[model samples]
Target: MTRVHDMGGRFGDGAVVPEADGIPQLGDWQARALALTLAAGALGQWNIDVSRHARERLSPADYGRFSYFEKWIAALADLLVETGVLTEEDLSGQEGDAPHPLADRVLKAEAVAAVLARGGPSERPSNVASRFEVGQAVRTLRPAANRLVDGGHTRLPAYAAGARGRIVRKHGSHVLPDSNAHRLGEAPEPLYAVAFPASELWADPEAPGDEVVLDLWQSYLEPA
Candidate 1:
């Protein structure tokens, strides 16, 4: 029998232990289950709280249903306030037509567009090979299908699978690593693109003769 120590409800290899009564205690698996349930509940509450905040400060037209997975909502709202789209006074108070107080500011269309234009920090790749160049022939690299469940990682979608293309452009010096691999802390490698026939991307495509440009990284392509 393993001696189980209670570390004041914290569970880890070296958690602090609290004095336990003789009652049989739950194991690590049980504790994890409970934690996961609580975390889910907290995430739900967070969405509700943020949504309510949005409705108050934002104009009626600007308010809409928000996604729980949008962690950057607060930051966006803050930017809105900073840009004068909404104000602290607008968010203040919890009465009148609005039930929820505006927790933050609302973003104007121009402000939103500006922010959208500035893409996030570049995630670079680890290993890469400069196998192709502009005006050079190249082919898509068909890798094994990913088995893991998708969430935040990036992978080549099925739509572009087995498609042939040409190197039409190079997006100067970027760390184009596998999105999924990058999420797991892998470095981003250089990336490139090969233009595919529109017919390749879509069967019975209207632009069958036209070339569809793809911004593929180095790892996603090989010499044709």
Candidate 2:
């Protein structure tokens, strides 16, 4: 199902204005939000896909109301509560200054730099072989109806759906977010970088020669 988070290529949405110097002007709370999220993720309660899906699960009103990091903090709170790491009382500041139950796995400050450098790699051994090869013409799977899609969480964007493209590069197998987010097995699939003509994605002639390339999973594409 199309949720509030899937706002790609939609019209009337304001342009994404970048910072003048292209540097992120993050506030203290926003910085804390990122650190808290990474720290909580270190506890191994859930995967990155689950974290993303959790943010998507926020109420439509909340999703729209919250800022970028605000959404992260809000979703992190819900996830912590759901995983029994924190309680409503804890969130409300009613709990005492007791040592955390999972203190053993607490991400230490000393390891932050190392942990950040050694990021969580999702590449895995594929159970199946690659289906499409590099430089193969393909088309993104169109939604059954005019509606975007019915699946809960997906990497496929609504605008890219039903568009014809060519596989420009092969990314090998990786964790499929659609399945992993919903507690399904990794179900690794071959991924490829598909390049589509600008005209196929947009009717205007502003940048017709430009191409939009997306890293798409094998299941999301077919022979065009």
TM-score of each: 0.41, 0.90
TM accuracy, model 2? 0.90
Q: How close is candidate 1 to the true structure, as a TM-score?
A: 0.41
Model 2 C-alpha lDDT versus the unseen true structure: 0.85
What is candidate 1's lDDT per residue for 1-224, written digit by digit as tens?
10111111222446557876797665665554444433332322223222233333343233334322221344344534554544666657432454333333333445545544653455444455566778887777554223232321224454665677788776644533333332333345656666778777675677657876767766666677
> What lDDT does the true structure give each of the candidates?
0.48, 0.85
Give the winner by TM-score. 2
Cα lDDT for residue 61, model 1? 32
Candidate 2 positional error at 121, Å: 0.8
Candidate 2, residues 66-152, lDDT tens digits: the string is: 998999999999999988999999999898888987989989999889889999888899987888877889999876121122456
Residue 215, model 1: Cα distance from true site in angstroms:
1.0
lDDT of 2 at 61: 99
